[model samples]
Target: MTTIQVGLYFLLGAYILFSIFFCTLVLFSTFADSVFIRYLSSTHLGKPVVYHLQQVVEWLEGPKCGICLAQYWSTGDMAPRVMNCGHTYCGSCIEIFAEQKDGMVICPFCTRTHFCNTIHPLPFFSENHLLIILCSSLITVNLWKCQTCRKKYSSQDVSRTPRVYSTCGHTSCEACVESDFTQKKRVVCLTCEGRSGGITVVAENWKPHVPINYAIRDLLKE
Candidate 1:
């Protein structure tokens, strides 16, 4: 083809590809945003625990404050705000529990500080409640999120503590990383790369699984 024709064809192809990509991006963005709004717009947690007693089966009959064991019967309408530890307390009481006497919110009973302050959806649901909501939402609606990988779950659940963590926030279960990759296949913690500290696969069991936890302790001992 002549140079002008070739250039025209290339331009047409580029325009078609660009239009397709733009349309796809717009649709995906709308769907994602709609889902997020619906998730947050929900008052699922505020729906008054019709099955609150189901949570602490033993405490069902004796629904008492998880922090002080103060009976719910003692406190009026200000219902118990349950923490993930399978414990419950008066909302105001837990507010006290979540307060910062020295600018730090520490759990009075378990001493798990600022645990309630993290951004999981608990303005209404606890861990158990969120699990129930997620399952039910999946059945009725197209709600989707992975707790470990999703941003919402991290803010809402505070997350599972990793066996290995990086400064950039890359984390993994020690056993998981150890078993997955082959030798010389570097699994750099995505967040911790170029930062300073992170778990490097020093050895493996199939080839000498030396967990970094052990390595750190040894280095300290040395």
Candidate 2:
């Protein structure tokens, strides 16, 4: 065969290989995304609970706050809070809304007004425990893996505390972080390095301590 013919054949073979790899990557990504979406939907619809309980939970937690349009967190000020009208909003937004209207919090969706004393009196709203549980479950399902060791976080294993690096924001179990630091004498983000083709230096905050990821820890507790 001519050299030109051989070169053309090689080019065709390379293109075929690239196309297969690209298609496989796309398929895998789609599958992962679909799984995540289905889990999210199940949480929203309260599929794991009894029919009656599901209805009640769904009514209490409607995914996001209408005022701020942000998804509820498991804890802290951004956590879901329920008013007297049974409508839920993030704790921060609800407090702001209540204060804006002179201690009368109006539900933006239903236009129902709830009065808060704002002084030494009955609290206007309460934390939505059911919604907090749901949010924590979602977070646990999605982010339970330790980036370094690739081990899953379990409530049974109270020893494993996930720690987030200050610079890279990647999380790994406390054991892995300590081991890595001991071996290398410095903390670096392996995941970031693998992806970006260079060493990504995490802040030297490991000298004194690496802060535990309270958000992940809180979810794992549930």
Using TM-score, give the best candidate's number: 2
Q: Which ranges of candidate 1 are over 4 A from the true structure?
A: 1-61, 73-77, 84-86, 100-103, 115-222
The digit string of per-residue lDDT tens for model 2 on 34-108 reads: 665457446856444334443333334435665787778877788876544445678788778766787777878
lDDT of 1: 0.37
List residue ranges in candidate 2 displaced over 4 A: 1-69, 72-143, 154-159, 194-209
Query: What is the TM-score of candidate 1?
Result: 0.24
Per-model TM-score versus the true fold: 0.24, 0.35
What is the C-alpha lDDT profile of model 1 across 28-53, one tens digit per residue?
44553465444543557622332232
- Distance from true location, Cα of 69 in model 1, Å: 3.6
- Candidate 1, position 198, lDDT: 39
